[model samples]
Target: MASLNVYSALVVLFFTRAAAMATKENDQIIKDNNCETKMGLPCVLEAFTSIFKTGTISSKCCGELVGFGKVCHTTLVKRTLENPLFKDLSPARIIVKSIQTWNICLALIDSPSPSA
Candidate 1:
């Protein structure tokens, strides 16, 4: 009976440690994909400001915007953008526009060349 108890305790300890490691890894993944770090406030501000002047989005910005959408999803993006820091910005509009632009860019890339 004592040996059985010891084995049970060891199993519990191993599972608990495994669970903690899994939780840590999940948290790290969330943190890495968060909008503040991935998309960034500065980048948004710059992109919005530049759109009027250039009428273009760089490939880097396009990728980051797409990634933000993929990571945060629509509801989370809306909630996060409701923060006071983003009160003046329209998250829905930006997200929609970004998606549209990304789609257009993707289509252009996938299109066959005139010569081909």
Candidate 2:
């Protein structure tokens, strides 16, 4: 029974990591599509937004989220700070979590995907 409990915990840990990675890739996709439309890539963002569930960004989206790791990060930190979410979150902790999530998706995308 103890062995089974340990195995279950490990599996849970693995899936949690998997989900985090998914979020990261999704973020990149969103950022990419956003840039295209912003720069006047005709019909790309419109086609993406019309179907995207998050109603935010696309799966093929790829690009550096502007102002990330710099002023934007600091800006979000301040915003999340004043907002109720970060009263306990703290800026550093939230950033660490964001990195971890991004890494997860990157790992999947980098891996030997079955389709390949």
Candidate 3:
């Protein structure tokens, strides 16, 4: 029983360290890419809501999100999933949503707008 407890503790420690490393790497990627400033606050909120909840992203926000670049978008989503507040959320589902959101935004941005 004691050995089992020790092994469990070691496993927990390893995961903790791995999570910390992942967070640090994510932070570095965000910083390096200047991701925080890529989109306006409203657009960020729209993107977050679109991915994390039942919300639609406006065409304007979709343009901004597409400009934000896929690297930044993906890294930010992954970081958010790592947060304990989102612990109950399914990572697979969230990832799928994120991809869908990206694709939708990309399509919206790529399509030619109608002339007045």
Candidate 4:
């Protein structure tokens, strides 16, 4: 029926608009995170390699982690959890230990120093 076609067209238009909005939103988040200029894909990949091996996150990488807003942080965590590489690497255990270590580093940076 014509009404059914109209409904289908509206649904498609709504979804297309939604997808464009989502893309723009994600672009903004990426910009806020300085992903292109600061957190390049190659750099993050390299840092993660070292992190997984020695459980030592470089200061640069740590800064990037702390820079992320809560939503971005949770999104990254979820994606990392879902990655097959993490499963092979036993990511949960590594993340627990790493969090403990990174916390110390993060705490120092987060704290304000006394001014003379």
Candidate 5:
């Protein structure tokens, strides 16, 4: 029983350290890529809502998000999922939504605009 408890504790400690290290690495990536400054606050909020809830992203915001780059977008989403406020959310579902949002934004940015 004591050995089992020790094993469980060790497993918990290992995961905690790993999660911390991942978060630190993600923060560095965000900083190096200037992820925070890439998009305006309103667009960022729109992207967040589009991924975290049932919402749509505007063409302008989609352009901002596409310009934000996939690496930065993915890192930001992963970091946001680490927040306690989103604890109840399903990571898998959120990730799928994030990918969907990125794809939609990418398509929007790549598509040609109508001529006047």
Candidate 6:
């Protein structure tokens, strides 16, 4: 579990390609799009950190990691745009590309790619 977390971050830093780059700039042109409404990713992370007890996976975390839970691979990339910290993030291409890239990277390492 410990190893997975670090690898996950590294995967985020590695992916340089993603299909989402095509129209990512003009994709979701929502003017007042707010993220608080979709803060599920952070909530999922906090939930894991709270349940990650020591080197062993807590039953709580395991339950969330297994079936019915999507946190095992999915990271909060879409939530970044709403985050005030990364709101002004430039090169929307890189941000959007990284999100899709990490998602695929995580899918490859955590599970099979979407039957590509």
The CA root-mean-square deviation of candidate 3, after full C-alpha superposition on the true structure, stands at: 1.1
As for TM-score, the candidate ahead, 4 or 6, is 4
Worst-scoring 10-residue span by lDDT in model 2: 59-68
Local distance difference test values of all predictions, in order: 0.57, 0.43, 0.96, 0.59, 0.96, 0.41
Count clashing residue pairs in model 2.
Answer: 3
Model 4 stretches with alpha carbons more than 4 Å out: 1-38, 41-43, 112-116
* Per-model TM-score on C-alpha atoms: 0.36, 0.31, 0.95, 0.45, 0.97, 0.24
Q: Which scores greater on lDDT, model 2 or model 3?
A: 3
1-116 in candidate 2: lDDT tens per residue? 99999999999999879756655555555465443333223333432232221233222331232212233333333333445543565557656544443344345445674774
TM-score of 3: 0.95
How many backbone clashes does every candidate have? 0, 3, 0, 0, 0, 0
- Once fitted onto the true fold, the runs of candidate 5 whose alpha carbons sit more than 4 angstroms away are none
* Pairs of residues at least 3 apart in sequence or in different chains that clash in candidate 5: none
Candidate 1 collision pairs: none
Candidate 5 lDDT by residue in tens digits, 45-87? 9999999999999999999999999999999999999888999
Error of 6 at 58 (Å): 23
Residues 1-116 of candidate 6 have per-residue lDDT tens digits of 99999999877766522434422432343223432233355444643343222123333333433332233223334434434565565536545454443443335456643665
Model 1 agreement with the true structure over 1-116: per-residue lDDT tens digits: 99999999999999979756755655555566664565766556544544312356566665555666544433344444444676677656667754565575456545665884
What ranking emerges by lDDT with the best candidate at the front?
5, 3, 4, 1, 2, 6
Query: Cα lDDT of model 5 overall?
Result: 0.96
Q: Which candidate is the best by TM-score?
A: 5
Report the C-alpha lDDT of model 4 over 1-116, residue by residue, as the tens digit.
Answer: 99999999999999979756765666667667655455556546644554466545556666665654344543344445555666677767656654664574477558776799
Q: For model 5, what is the error of residue 37's alpha carbon versus the real structure, in angstroms, after optimal superposition?
A: 0.9
lDDT of 1: 0.57
In model 3, the worst 10-residue window by lDDT is 104-113
**What TM-score should be assigned to candidate 6?**
0.24
